[model samples]
Target: MSDQSSDAVPAQWSAPTAPGGDPIEKASGENFPVALRLLPPRIREDLRALYRYARHVDDLGDEWAGDRLSALDRIEADVRGLYEERREPTDPVVAALASTIARRRLPADPLLRLIEANRWDQQVTRYETFDDLLAYCRLSANPVGELVLHIFGRATPERIALSDRVCTALQLLEHWQDVAEDYRRGRVYLPQEDLRRFGVAEEDLARPTATSQLRALIAFETRRAEAWLDAGAALVAGLSGRARLAVSGYIAGGRAAAAALRRSDYDPLSRVPKPTSRQIASAWIRSVIRGWG
Candidate 1:
């Protein structure tokens, strides 16, 4: 862990001048506040700036439902320019992100990986196995955890491993929650291998309610996510003070979400279960105490 802010370019990038340049509008409410509010003021600002940039990349992947490839190319170009600190082209998210990149020394690999995942979404709709879905999670999920590690000054090999577990678990939980919506988009995050193993057909996922096989598959995935949460719980112990609390919040959120899914009997088709505020509060408190202990 090194704080290399002083070794980089000055953090003086300008804001975009265009009207209505906010990027938070591009993300669902759930994606925007992963660690933004719980952080100190300056760190929260930096995290929001990074999140806005990531959200912009995601929007380019998703919003242009008809011409995703072209949109992704443009977004990629903008991201490259931001990384290079070329100010000639001005975009709101890029402007904010350029400063964040210079100040935080955040690498370009994670950002590019996220864009690539979105590109994959544009063309690849079916995952043949759990490994394939995990590959998708590498692109779609792992970067956020890497960025969080960067923010905490804790980008160790061990911490990154824990972060990956947490991120992948969260991504899987989200897929479980958005089963119907993903199906509506002509995509399926459920691996074909598990589907077959549990005797669930792709067509069954489209139905309004889960068949017994579907319930079995969902339960299996829930168990896997729980395992990830447990494996990644060490990330909280590895940190201290506010950094510890932040990591705990992330772990607790995933656990609470999984608990909600369990409460629903892993019935992804009938309804998507989400953690209630009470559950979030309870999980947060428990995680904090656990970290302390």
Candidate 2:
């Protein structure tokens, strides 16, 4: 996915979850399950704790209209508190993450990277090149996979590589789906070069429907994502038991989102594409029958 990870781990993760209430609702509001039923109860809290941090950071970055950088600075300070063994954290997200950090002995770097991604969001509204976008992913999406590997104790060199591929692919897919929404929010995730190459001006995205060039561009990006996703096939194939199934859901969800885009002729402006229940069930069933990476 990127050059950030030097020593990868084994690909053996499979799920995310949370207990009933505010955190759980926010966690479930995510596209993929943050705390899924397939994972163990012990894994659920830690996974949601991580998601709680990410979700809050994302809100401050993308949704808040105020001084996001200043708010994020506070978040960074609390992240340090988690590692410093502070008796208590005022922020509930950091408070929840404390035990998980101590229990797993997780590095603070991955969590900080996520925060850094949001910090970049405050300064960057558009990416000029594909490489530049990938650089953002290195800070934004890839850290979640890295954190997950660390949680599973499988942050080996090989697994990190595979996780990087999967996380980046998913991040790209999210950008594709949010073309209309991101534009309205004063952000655009599509590379500027690609937009120029395809004759897709920013105005084209502001329209009620995708222009033909925009559709073609979306289709091309979707195919590109699928190819990138294939790099993680070995990851799905290598794991076993519940962990394997959990990882399979991630790929399945991405493929389903791609399918929705295809079904609409890649016209994301018409509607955002999401995975349906049947499609998600099929993904799990197929993995059960066919075997996971």
Candidate 3:
């Protein structure tokens, strides 16, 4: 899809000063901070700007309690206006985003895809097959990787393919960890085909401990996520310096998360699996060494 425009700042452009703003927190949070710390000052600032915008868009989709569809529509409009630089955005997130778009020449399609994925969450609740879930990942996950590529100015077709695999694997790992919470959200990330193959029902996901069927299903999905990480690992070789470090961090994060799932024995209802700091550090070291070699 063509971008909205690149001229004319919007009428709403102003500083965002909300105390404890959700978007601000997400931008500064642990997950987005991974690559930011490894970047130069200017690039880090730019990433923070981009992250704030994306975070605001996601929060509008995930955290808004009332009229989520309307909120998402507004976010989409704001995104278009931000790209066009036609509307004055009062929120700091939007303000930062507008500047990043102007400076980086970032495309509008990834942002639009992200907003559309949030819109999908409002209507879609179940995934019937792996392909179905992958379609969702195309929207809900892959744009982040695309944005990362755009920031680094390294968006070749092959790199994008590898990045897609890594990003989708990260998304799947997240889903595996959040099985209980997703169920509470009236969503399930496990493809129905696999669930049927393992003879696991939706109700079985709510149990405190997983049954044999649930364990089997989780193991199956975990292996798929691992395969994605393995396939995408070459993305590190395709980059250098800070960009390489950033991609390595991403790969390490996925591997660490997957290891956490394995350590948890694929139980979904007990608690979400999270990698310890030690595990992440070890993985990062290994990633660096491997990259050097």
Best by TM-score: 2
Clashes of each: 0, 20, 11
Deviation (Å) of 91 in candidate 2: 1.2
Model 1, 54-130: lDDT tens per residue? 77667667664345566566557777876676643344566667767777888888888888999999899999988
Global lDDT of each candidate: 0.73, 0.75, 0.75
The residue pairs that clash in candidate 1, if any, are: none
List candidate 3 segments past 4 Å from native: 1-36
Tens-digit per-residue lDDT, 76-185, candidate 3: 67778876767775445565677777777788898889888888888899999999999999898888887888888888889999999988888898898889988988
lDDT of 2: 0.75
Candidate 1: where is the Cα deviation over 4 Å? 1-36, 87-89
TM-score of decoy 3: 0.87
- Cα lDDT tens digits, model 2, 194-262, are 999999999999998999999999999999887777787678666665556667777776677677779
List the candidate 2 regions with Cα displacement exceeding 4 Å.
Answer: 1-29, 33-35
TM-score of 2: 0.88
